[model samples]
Target: MENTSTTLTMTRRFDVTAEKVFDAWLNPEMMKKWFFTMEPTNKVTKNDPRVGGSWEIVDHREGKDYRAIGEYIEVDPPSKLVFTFKMPQFSDMEDRISVEIKPVENGCEMTFTQIIVIPHEEGWTEGDIEKAHNEYSSQTEQGWYYMFLGLKQLVETGKVKYPS
Candidate 1:
């Protein structure tokens, strides 16, 4: 069987330097504050932020641990980062994500793109693949929306403000 893939892109402007926004994605200390979970205290982040290096983040929620593991494909400070993302507990599918940061007059803007790929089963039709892509993209977008909120707060104020 082959595989189907879809791309989702999101952009956010920050009132901070490009380097600061870019660093938030790689620095384990900074990542724990805004990367995955609202409860930073319960999150563990370990990163080797370089090309070919690997990173892992585990968020402990409700007595369950959610793990995201990935390998860095490209790391360009103050500019771009590309990585492969996978959650072993959820599925064997691996996704590629690229984050590009550009300096603007006020601060900076980040463009994040994720390519989600899933295996195509024998009985799956075009509609089936499209539906799966839509669902996956929606969930991923929602998750990143919250994460970007936390990232903005942390980078701009040196702290995160959890949503109420």
Candidate 2:
């Protein structure tokens, strides 16, 4: 459709090793620990971490069934990764996501970027677009940040703890 458009892109950096950091996303059990916080909240909806991986999280505030079902565009093991994220309910969004890892003395620097494409405005109002975009970016940033932190805590300490 002519109206299909990509509105925003967000990037966040994490302080951790690329290997450890990537594992948090690639590993199913590990991802559940920090990926999506429960509903105000209920149970974990869905969580899978593979090339055709899928995930869904439900809370009183938001209900999202994340579908990252695409062949790995690129996988460089601890160095770089690329995948697709599609959420149909949110105006036909097909997000092209990528992560880059750079090794550092302390650990690794992780940079994540997500490009979200929307088909229609759907129920959004006048200024709602800004709010939606900002909220999405912030929420994703927090999720990734927590993932990195969890990954770091796990590798550095050999234990993983979920947020309460």
Query: What TM-score fits each model?
Result: 0.94, 0.60
lDDT, each prediction: 0.89, 0.58
lDDT of 2: 0.58
For model 2, how does the per-residue alpha-carbon lDDT over 105-124 read when each residue is reduced to its tens digit? Answer: 87777666777553336776
Q: Would you list the clashing residue pairs of candidate 1?
A: none
lDDT of 1 by residue, 1-164 (tens): 77888899999999999999998998888888878765554467999999999998888876899999999999999899999999999888899999999999999999999998867778888898888888988999999998998999999999998755
- RMSD values, in order shown: 1.4, 5.1
- Model 1 misses residue 76 by how many Å? 0.8
Clashes of 1: 0
Task: Give the poorly placed runs of model 2, Cα more than 4 Å off.
Answer: 1-16, 37-71, 88-91, 118-131
**Which 10-residue window of candidate 2 scores lowest in summed lDDT?**
1-10
- Compared with the true structure, the alpha-carbon lDDT of candidate 1 equals 0.89
Candidate 2 residue-wise lDDT at 57: 49
